[model samples]
Target chain A: MSITQISVFVESRPGHLTRTLEAFAEAGIQVRGFCAGDTGEYGIVRFIVDRPDAAMALLAERGAAARTSEVLCARLDDRPGALARAMVACAQAGINIVYCYSLAATCIALSVKDIASAEAALADADIDLVDQAELARVLAGATL
Target chain B: MGTPMPAPDQIDFSALPIYLPEVECTSRERIRAIQLAKLIEQVGYTYARVPWYRDQMDALGVTPADIRTLDDVRKLPFTDKSALRETFPFGMFAVPMDEIVEMHASSGTTGKPIVVGYTAADMDVWSECIARLAQMAGVTAADRVQMAFGYGMFTGGFGLHYGIQRIGGMMIPAGAGNTERHIQMIEDYGTTTLIATPSYAMHICEVGEKLGFDWASSTLERGLFGGEPCPPRLKAEIEARMHITCTDNYGLTEVMGPGVSGECLAHRDQQHIAEDHFLWEVVDPATGEPVAEGEMGELVLTPLDKRGIPVLRYRTHDLTRVTTEPCACGRTLARMQKVRSRCDDMLIIRGTNVFPSQVEDVIGRIDELTPHYRIVVDNEGGLDRMTVEVEIKPEAFSDSFEEMSAFAREVAGKLRNVLLVTPVVRLVEPGGIERTLGKAKHVDDRRR
Candidate 1:
């Protein structure tokens, strides 16, 4: 019902974002979805990667500041307003969306305050939630 | 190359070894002789005028006549910021209000602000001291100096303003803040020298880079950074970013602003103290006993030339060591090392002493982290917990769970290595820490 999202704290400097992505690439960790929220001096880079632990170790080795949080991944039709429909369900369920981004094709990742409630709301609305194992498979370039 | 040699004394270069060559370049023996004379007169005058000093001297069973030699200065009682606070606004003034030409005060963030007054004669000495410091930093009458320190009640702005005016330097009272405008002014006015706190100078560089301003090629040749103790890392960073010769200066409102001591261009490691104007001593803060020469301790100062508020053994609360060794700048005045930290800002966490500046040093060195951070000390259960909330560079952000945790652990380890206490390091967004235009707030203690 929920997918684990890794969020890394990045300073607002040239090549910081590149350094972070390179850390994952060097470790051969494939990221399925990504969203970055910037506040001038720093940005929060959130990722749904195939090998999170390995990616984290590589980033740690390079001395990058990062963290992790949970978000829900829902299967949606590759059509217009699919994201808006999933978001409307979340809003109706009273689950606030911190941020959301597209995951591969026909999948959408939504960060929320309460993952369980968001999952319950989406289930009630007949929206299927992708689990972490499924996310790993999808991020590995497998068609979901 | 074929020009005839000119007489040594005939050249009269505008740049001199000392602003007041007769006093600053005088023999050490003569300097002390002058200090002793000024000390005796100041002691007697304070004892006669200020009731607090008279009571303190009376309690110590020491009279003005007992202060016969420079060593006799130990006989006088120590005056700390608390004494100045107790007296409040005008009680510390030795001379009457009519004689006070200018007044300044500390921030007083905790409680009452410590106020200080200066007479016209005292202002003359202040200007001369600042001029000497300016000349040391390569500022001359021909240059334009932009003062970034705040004006009004705070002393830094007015102190340097008058000092630069005294040296005949074109003064730009830019005050503080408005980074874009400050840079524009520098471009428009050709500001050759800048007077600001070290942190503010670093911030200016950040803004300059963001605005696509070429700060490296700016007219800023010298930076007189003071108001807060500047770490060597910060100084290096400022110099590298701004391409300016940055020198540190020290002063307090309790004493006089900005003119207490400053670094000469030849030697930026230690600051030259204006010994003739103010009698300085290094004493153990705990015992109030004078420490040996070259030993680190709290600074005790007594204004010898100040008439508005002649203080007796006023504790500066700043920690540093003094060396009488002659500087490469050719000035005979004693130089004090850059201030390490303030005793007041020192935090004791679970019996271990920690300075926020130390944490700042560590953060400054880490390229991934910005120097802006907050030290949060809170009481957790039965023990005290220290958490350092530092900003991560926006470019370093990655959504990797393992990466973020590892980064936090590494930062915590680095901090524990220096502080000897394990602190929970919280890495927030790049702009998470609050930025202030004035002195940066490094600590937020909630244990109290």
Candidate 2:
């Protein structure tokens, strides 16, 4: 019920972001979604890529500090309050949302405190969650 | 599965005849004669080949013939790091480029690095010298030596590389970084000896703690540590943590990587200089005059048999004293005290030498970073951790977390590139770091 998310520690500089993107581009890795947070000196560049392992290998080959973690993605109808409902379901289940981001209007990726509880909560709420296979298909440019 | 590790006291190094017993155990008079002859030949070769040496000798009004006795070495002008820097890429090379089969360099205060070359013969001498030091430190053919020093332009890696090979030990050339991999190798390969900077060795211990990898339980018996000084307290702490005795080594890139001197396993107090190949002197840093024996002073060395870039009376800037008293190990080679400090602003972190000015230069290149920065060095579980706290330009201050983190990583990466060491780069608000009047304090060393 989750996809592998690779997070790289990138120094916050002018060319760092550019170089990282260029590295991904050169490796021909497609990024489905990404969210970044900066703490002045460095930034965490997180990516949801088609080939997470390949993307990580490319970053490692480039000597970029990176790591992979599991993040949950839910497929919702293209409408407002869809994320709010999913988040409310997780909040009701006592699953805290660490961070959340969305690429298309219908797909929302969220990192939660408890993966199993969040998945159970989403399942009980009749919300369709994308597994690794569905996420891979989406990352491969397939319509959800 | 692996051989039993030996206790520090149980490691019998004295019983093993010293490497190169003929040279190491030679009489003081005979050693002096060898030094005098090699000094004469090397000085003449330097003056004839290296234009910088010839010009310096001419300016000092001293010729190669002036070096008749070992005392006459004082007549020649002392070569400092500045002299080496001024020569740049290849000016100080006594041998032609073709003859120099290998080259290594260390970071200078500025952008230009101090380049050192080694001929095939020089490489042999380097290996032999390192092998002698290694053997003195109690490494043997049965031991599997894991070298953690980075293998590249830096001399520390290759110095240990050839030396371990000369000793006929199984070498796992595990270059620097990836502490996890190093620990895995130790567990998988049954590594007996570890060669790394004392700081790096400490860092590996920290990694072991995080992964719950018991280094004390590992097959690592002894460590040959150099590239920086290891104090008694630190040495003891490392020995306690890893259950191994660490012998501190001393060397310079200009002289010949890490073969200059090392401590015998029998005595962990002082490093024995390879007197047969290099002549050492402890002198006043200011006056460049020789200090009394056993007195703390700057180290000066002249390569007696070095051919590629023969360094004559080269001031090492490393502050230490030389003692000629016989060691219990039975080697007659003179022992130099452990180096605690330098005569300059250079700082050694995890075996990589770094200068504040070099770091400042890198910071200055970034538009978002202000020139104000403070380097704080701390010893966390015997590992040296450097944190560079710098203020960001007010105009560049961003509320977005992405911008801030991206900037920090960039600075850290650039620093890792130039310094060959990764420092925790912390960005503060403008004017966060204090300003000083006279000589701005760039480094706050809290390791002690």
Candidate 3:
């Protein structure tokens, strides 16, 4: 199962992230989990939001360059080596995890090249996978 | 007799009067005869006055008598910038200091500046040559010409100034920079013609836009651009934005500056050379052999009647094609294509030759990319790597990393198709690259 993630292109400068968050705040879009990476000249900010479609529409209205992509969310054991086990399962199944980040205490989000194979491999490894609806439900209940 | 004539603004530029019709509109045979006689005279004149010329000719065992036909011009020794540097200031002057009336030198960013002295007669010839070029580009005596080219040691400003004076036009003499003042003068004086590099003209348009100055509303109608290569795309942008017809002229300080060849309004693609004053030849940069007809090669020029500082077969290092076919503008002089790049600007990346102009042409063709770019070459692990940093149009930015990555790949693919070597294309933010008022620097080689 996969959930939609929003990636925003921003120039690498002061107040850019703050401005992006302000735009989301003004639009009443709740960002569940977010991470940013830089490439000297510009940065890419990826967000797991409550309403991705609305956020994307808002970003478009603001003339911001952004895109939505599917990412797999996995509910892991609240213990050490939880991510390692999931990574090992994907690696053994020859699934490429493009990027991964922690969403909550025992919930992690991963962007993989082969989402179907990655979801199947994680399910086979006895790990629970979260879809879009389940991820919204968890984010609603969790204090963030 | 019943049909109405077009307004002055709507008149066809091709119908404009040739400044020196006797020479510019002459027969090719007569042009060749004039070139042969001038070449013979120039060779002997240089041999007698300048020791550098005599020594170079003696070493090759070639005498002035050897140059009988125009084809024999190949036998003369080629004078390059290094030769001028060896002679330094005033050493290459064929005339005495009292005869020299004016002097100009290149910016010489690399080392010592190469000086050029113009006698009173030489100044008159320079003015006439520029006037002929100005007329070819549709500059009329009634138009108010504003010069944005700097008027100092650089030849651009003074060359155009003298030419505009000769044409009896109202000269604004605005000089370079102070963009706001230039804009004000253009509006207040109703300037109809602008003398500037294409890049500066583009910059002025941008600044004008920022200041709420409407370029289309302004009286600017013609642009005489030189000092750097103006690609057709950039020229079109300036013309559309400023509502002006942009013309490109070619020149170098080593030869007579800004008077070698210029584009007429009728045939905007090629520039008509002042063949009466200078003999032009296109030869392969490597072997110095003539290229096939209408093929690109290094431009070699020999100033025929220059008395103060005479040069024979001076290698311009600029690469362009030349065609002797008569122009539609009624000029029988040879026409050379706009010089897009120089031989010295060629970069050997990973054993493959690449020119910045090629990269520029590729970038200009893509809709989402801007012409502003920098070619950075660095050696890593004893292997050369070229990175083309291109600015993306603000409207073309995509928030998706995948889409942007694909766009970069597409640009790189196009570049590889042209250059035969793949380069890492980095999409930069709009206005990320620096702009210049003078010649734009395109290469950044860190391998050295």
Instruction: Report the number of clashing residue pairs per model.
Output: 21, 22, 2
State in Å the error of residue B309, model 2.
Answer: 0.7
Q: What's the lDDT for residue B329 in model 2?
A: 78
C-alpha lDDT of residue B62 in model 2 = 91
Instruction: Estimate every model's Cα lDDT from 0 to 1.
Output: 0.80, 0.81, 0.85
Worst 10 residues of 2 chain B by lDDT: B1-10
> How many clashes does the backbone of model 2 have?
22
Instruction: List ranges where model 2 is wrong by over 4 Å.
Output: A1-144, B1-13, B344-448
lDDT of 2 by residue, A1-144 (tens): 788888775556777677778888877877788888875666667887778888878876765556687888898866788778898899898888878887544677888768888899998888888977877665465321
Best by TM-score: 3
Q: Write the per-residue lDDT of candidate 1 for residues A91-112, one digit (tens) a residue.
A: 8878888778877767888877
Candidate 1 stretches greater than 4 Å from native:
A1-144, B1-17, B345-448
lDDT of 2 by residue, B1-448 (tens): 3233354477654566477989998888888889888889998988998888888889989998788889999998888778878878888888779999999999565668999999999999999998988888778788899999889988999888898898789899989899889989999999988888888898998889898887657888888887766756667788888888678688888888888988885566688899989998888776787889987678999989889888888888887779888876778889987675676766768876566766776887888877879999998998999999887764565434556677788999998887789999897645557788735788998875
- Chain A TM-score per candidate? 0.89, 0.92, 0.94
Of 2 and 3, the candidate ranking higher by TM-score = 3
CAPRI tier of model 1: incorrect
Q: Per-residue lDDT for B349 in model 2?
A: 83
**Where does model 3 sit among the CAPRI classes?**
incorrect
- Per-residue alpha-carbon lDDT of model 3 for B113-188, expressed as tens digits? 9899999988998999899889987787987999998899999999889988998988999888999899999888
